[model samples]
Each structure stands twice: as structure tokens, then as C-alpha cells.
Target: MGKPTGFMDYSRQTAEAAAPRERIKNFNEFHIPLSKEEQQIQAARCMACGVPFCQSGMELMGMTSGCPLHNLVPEWNDLVYTGNWEQAYNRLAKTNNFPEFTSRVCPALCEAACTCGHYGDAVSVKENEHGIIENAYEQGFARPKPPKVRTGKKVAVIGSGPAGLAAADQLNKRGHQVTVYEREDRIGGLLMYGIPNMKLEKHVIDRKVNIMREEGVEFITGANVGKDVKTAKLLKEYDRIILACGAKNPRDIKAPGRDAKGIYFAVDFLSATTKSLLDSDLRDNKYISAKGKKVVIIGGGDTGNDCVGTSIRHGASSVTQLEMMPKAPDQRADNNPWPQWPKVCKTDYGQEEAIALFGHDPRMYQTTVKEFLKDKNGKLCGLITVKLENRQDEKTGRMVMAEAPGSEQKLEADLVLIAAGFLGTEKYVADAFGIALNERTNVKTEPESYETNVKHVFAAGDMRRGQSLVVWAIREGREVARAVDESLMGYTNLGA
Candidate 1:
């Protein structure tokens, strides 16, 4: 441990975010990171417990507890405290493929399971991680180093999200020539378009991608495998193929007046805004505009909150979010103990902006859209919502959300965005490869395996495991790379 009493000596600290109203004027990262000196103080707060649950990546109560990557949290935190940032970056890179992305987007599951947090505030592990990576970049320690030898094996990675990128990075490091194919015009799948710019700037992705290119990982954008590119060609050309195409099918709301105009999927709406912002800074007016409209978003997940924030930035008159589940408690319940994923209410950036602008929270818990209201022109004018209550099923004896009678209400909504989440992998990609899918629609694979039923083909990430966090996707990528390597060379020494 860097300091035996460090946890007691220093309180928890993190990067500061801009005021909600002030930051809504533009789409840019708002967090002001702590200085190196200040970060060292925060890093010292890590107790480096004898049993470091912060890195355990285990499951508890049907939710992930710590970091899915199983990051060497204590080792790097000590390095940061001792003024060894280069070594900290090295230790971080040993497990996590992209600290830059996760440091910003991850929910800090490590902190949730931190020993210090059992009573007091958790050590700022995520900020320490961010500092190490950003400092590494400034010092040129993150430069690419191509492999010295070639195994003469070829691999094709479909999708360029975290999973595909991690897989390609690992395989390329193992001296295999790897090429990544992205269906979109850009490399990042969800990271590029699905996620808004304010949370993670695009230049960060480009920086890492450029380094991977220098390390001999070829990326082909606008190449939709299984559609534009033939599956047979890939099967014949490459020694193995890894499918990292994420879960692309968005779950839709089935309700009355579903065909009304001005309603769009959450990903489609977010992607349009990002593409337009990147292509011309919104000057071309080629994207969906929420300006001067009363927006209603379905689903109270991260995507929905992102829509709320994006709409506020676009000058929306008002915004509302509907969540079918009951509101989580402000504090952890007796059944919810330390080291488990905390089920609590969290007001994200978008809702914070809404509160600052509208003088109230935008979410309506235990509420769901019952029907869409349209005018004579077939444009979405409003929505009817109904309240829900928890009820126990007689057959299954499980709790379920059931509609409460006499609770329907209508609200003005010029634009509607569905952020209800995703179903599974798209049919075309699975059909083109002729791989079998499980009941959940994910590519079928044996438990604890990444290989598919088809020979010389494997699956990973959301394509293999449905909708999930980016950290989990990266782990799946690392594991899939190891599997592919073993198939290619009979044995493997690659890390998962």
C-alpha cells in the first residue's frame, strides 16, 4: 500500500463538471480533471485492501459488482500516488485495452465495490485511471508499437466497436495480420454515433484508432459484412472470422398510432445528430432537430438521458421521460449490501440540465406510454401514458409491472424518441454467416465459450451476449481473441 492510513488521511475527490445550464449551450466535454498533484492525493486514498473486491468482476444479485475487465486497480492507484504515471499506464494497459474510453463512459463499478466505500466515500479510482491515460498520451507513452514478427495468419473482425477493436488489437499484438470491417462510415459502432459527443469526444476514438493502424490493424469503414461484402469471400480469405457486430435491433413500443410521424428510434436519433455534428458542425441541418419542440422519450436508461441532454442542447422547449419501473430508493435498502451493484436513483447530466432549466425532474417513474396522439397531418402531437403498479404473477409467482386502472393521462409531445433498449443481433448478419442463434436471439455458443457452431467463426460482445456495458464487451473481445488464436496456432498465450 502507498500509505497505510491513506484512506483515512485523504477524502475522496473527482473531476468537476460544469454547471448544467452553462454547459447546455454547446456539445463538449464538461468535466475539469484534477491536476496531477491533486490526483495523487486521491489515488492515495485507495486502502489496497487484502481482498480487493474492486477488481473482482463478479456477479451479485443479478447485476455486475465490480469492473468487468478485472482491472489491476490497487497496483495502478499506488503507482499514481508514488508519482510513477508511466508505470501506472503500463499496469492499466496490461488488462484494459482502452482506458481512455472507459475512464469517461464506465459507471465506476470499481468504486461501488471499493472497501473504503463500505462506510466512507470510495477512492476515486476512475479519475486516477483517467489521469494516468491522459498523462500517458501527453508524454507519448501511448504510441503504437507494431509487432516484430508475423505468424502469417489472417483474421477478419466484423464491427469496430470496443469489442472488435480490442480483438483486433490483441490479435495484431500476437503477430497475426488482422483487418476490421465496420458497416458505418466511421470505425466506432456505438461509441461513434450511439453515444453523444459531450460524454466522449470523437477525437479520442480517432487517436486510438490511428495508433492501432500504425500497429498494423487495418480498418475498412462502410463495408457492411454479410450484405455488401460476401460472407463466402471472408470465409475463404481469412483463417478465422470474429463477429463483434453489436446488438443493433432496438426494442420498439407497440401502441396505438404507432405509424405516426415525428417518432424515431433512440439510436437513429442519436446517430443522426452525431453524424451531422461531425460532418458539418450542424451547419448543414441534415440531422433531426428537437429545437422548439416538446420532446417525450421512452425508457429511462442512459440513452434516454442522453436524448434529454441532446434535446436541451438543441434548444428544445421542454422534455419528459417515462420509466415503467418504480423509482429506486435514495439510499441502499437492507437487502442491498456493500459490494453489490447499488440500486439507487441517479440523476444524470440530461436530467440535471432539465431540472436546471425546467425547475423539476423530467422523469415520471411507474409510467409508460399507452398510445401516440396525432393530428390531421399525421404528425406526432401528443402521447397518452398510464400509471403502473407492481403485481405478483399467479403462475410464475414473480413481480411484474401491471397497468393501474383509471390512470391514463395525455401530454404534449411534438417529437418522440424510443430508448427502450435492444433485442439482439440483426437477422441479416446472423443469416449471412449461417450461425445459429439462441432463444434470446444472441449468437448461440456453449457456456464459457466464444466459438460459434460454424467452423472457423466466432462471436463476442453484444452480438454474443445481448445489450451490455462497454467494459463487458471489451472483456468478451479479449477472450474471443484468445479463442481464435488457439484455433489458429493450436495453443495461445494471449490474455483475456
Candidate 2:
């Protein structure tokens, strides 16, 4: 625990973000971290509550309430407060494999469930975590520690996202020979491209990947399994195969003129920009150009917001975001009590940039694209959008967003980005592996197990659990690693 009365004595403070306008000029991490001393002070604010829900990864009201990795938030906070940097890092590394990735991209469900946050500000757990990890890297504490004894059990992990990386790290730590396969040219599946650089710099991923490589984990990039690499070969070569390829099937927008030239999937647009940025610093003109063009993004989730920010960085003339759901309350609703994930409106960094540049919030609530308008040459020109209202479905007994009859509107749009989310794992990957898919299209596994119907083959992460947070994927990875270790060696001591 931290100082007994530190929550009362010290106020909560976090890293300051660079102004949106200034940061829009280049794609880089914009959050300036707090000094070591300031971070220690912030860590001191973790109150010694008898029950710390901040680390309790429980679901309440059908929403996750805290860190899915079940990170030892209070313990690490106390270590940070006591200036025990190395120990803090050790405690952090116990449960979560990639604190760097979580600290940057996580929504901080831990903070939302913090006891102190019930009445006042929550402890700066995420920032404190960031400080600890970054400081560990700065010091010599985070050096590679390859296992001395090799069990000679080879594990082939398909995909190099957080889940795959975590499984590879843990299994390797347990003396299993682990090899990671990535379809993309680089490691870090979504971490490398799905997320924009302004949120998480690519170097952060590379740094940890280098550490993994040094620790005896083998990584093969540009290996597209199912299509290029044969599953039967992997089955014959490796002792076990763990499918962590992630849910790569993007849900498409179906409407008239859907084949227009100027429309692109959000993932494709983001991936191209990042690939080009890494390859030639955007000098190659390899990405979809938003420069001097009007942009409209469908699906008002994180990906949609990312599109808004990316477009702004590309000097978009104007940007608009279509959201099918109504805007959430500015503050937590009475029904949405403490400890449950707050169902409130959050203006993320992307939206902030759009507002600062456009002088207005770009989101249109309860609106959806009715049709894509294209020119004679098959180029996207504009779009027809319709307002939606919540209506009760008679047979289903559920609320549905139905179109409002007289609320159609037309807007000029030079480009459209569909961020409508994913359905599940790609069919080709599943079919090639000879694995069954659940109703949701994710890899089918028995309840509370990573074992697939196929013997010696396992599944984890988004491929098994559907599209989810990076932290959840890491948790799955760790759990699957434990399962594989236990299966390989009659009994194992790896933490889940």
C-alpha cells in the first residue's frame, strides 16, 4: 500500500499532453511524461483501501471494471512511492507482459474502478506504470534474461500482436523454444499499424521486440500463414501450435455505390500510412491521400477517431464522423454507479485535434450513411446520411437503431473511411488450420480452455475471444502459455 493518507494529502496529477494544433504537424507520441519525483508523488496517492478494485478484473453490468491483466496496481504504486524502481518493475512484470503497450493504449479501466475515484480523483496508475516501465528501460534493469535451461518443446505462435508476443515471451521464459510468425513485414500486428503513431510510437514496439529477439525468441516476418505458410508443415515441425492471428476480418459497409474508388477500410488506410512512414517518412506517396479532401468516417469508435486524426495530419479540408449510437451522457449516469466502467462521453486525442482544427466537434450522433454517391467515373463524390432513433423490436425485445423516415441529408465527401469494426477471424486462416469457428466467427474452443477441436492445436487472443482490448489479449496469451506449458510438461509453474 502507499502512504496511508497520501490520497488526502496529494492531488492526482498525470502526464501533460502537447496541444492538439502543434502536435498535428507530425506523427509522434504527444504526451509529455512527469518527472520521476512528480511520478513518485503521484504514486503516493494510491490510498490503502482494504479492497482494491483497481486490480480486480471483474465484469459488472456486462462491462469490465478494472485491469484485465489483473495488474498489482496498489502494490506497484506503493513500490513506486517508496522509490523502489527495480522492485516496482518486477511486480509489474509479474502479471502483465507488455506494460509499455498497455500504459500507452489502455483506457485505464483500473482508474475507473479505483476506490478514490468514487468520490474524487483516481490514482495516476497508468502514468505511474508508464514511469516505472520507461525508467526500467532507461536503467539497466530491463535487460534480456534468456532461460538457461531449454525444455526443447517448440511452440509456433501465429501472429505477432500483443497476444502472440505475450505467449511467446512466457513460453520462452519457461525454456520452450518459441517462434512467432507475422504476416506483415514488421512485428506487432495491430500495435505496428492499427493504432496511429501519435498514440503509440512504432519505436516503442521495436524496442521490446529487440529485447524478445535477444531473449531467444525467434520471429519470422512477412509470413502469411494459411495462404503462404502451410499449417500442416507447422504441425509437423513444432510440438504445439497456438493460433493468435487476431480477428482480421473487417466488417464492410454495404450500400449503393460501395465500389467507389475513394472509399477504404480504416485498417488499410492506417496500415499504409504507418508502413510508408516507416519505409520513407511519407515521401513515397504510398498511402491514401486525404490532403485537401473532405473526409467522412463511419462508425464512431476508436478507429473512427483515429481516421479523424490521421486525416487532419494529412491536411484534410474537412472531416465528419458518423455514429449510429446516440451520444453518451457527459457525466456518468445514476444507473452507471462506481466501479463499473463509466458510460460517459470521452473526448479522446483524435477528437480533440479535430475540434481544435475545425472549431467544432466532428461527430454526428445517431447518424448512419444511407448510400455512397459516386461520379460517372466511379469516384466517390458525396454521401447520403440518415438520422436514426432507438425503437423496441417486438419479437427480440431489444432496442434497435431504426432509420428516421424524413431525416435524410446529403454531404459532400471526397473520401470515406469505414471503421465499422471486425466480424471475427479471417475464414482462410481458420479453414487452412482445419479449426472450427464459433457463432461469432472466432476460433472455437471449449469453455474456459484454449484447446481447439484439433488435437495439439490451441487458440488465444482475438482469434479465440473476438475483437477485444490489447490488455485482454495479453491476458489470454499468458493464460494460453500456462496451458501449453502444463500440457508440454506434466505440470508447470508459469503464471497466467
Write down the lDDT of every candidate, Cα atoms only. Answer: 0.95, 0.94
TM-score for each model: 0.99, 0.99
Write model 1 residue lDDT over 1-496, tens digit each, in one string. Answer: 6688899888888899999989999999999999999999999888888999999999998988988899999999999999999999999999999999999999999999999999989999999999999999999999999999999999999999999999999999999999999999999899999999999999999999999999999999999898899999999999999999999999999999988999999999999999999999999999899999999999999999999999999999999999999999999999999999989999999999999999999999999999999999999999999999999988999999999999999999999999999999998999999999999999999999999999999999999999999999999999999999999999999987
Clash list (residue pairs), candidate 2: none
Off by over 4 Å in 1: none
Write one digit per residue (lDDT tens) for candidate 2, span 277-369.
Answer: 999999999999899999999989999999999999999999999999999999889999999999999888889999999999999999998
Off by over 4 Å in 2: none
Error of 2 at 430 (Å): 1.0
- Model 1 clash pairs are none
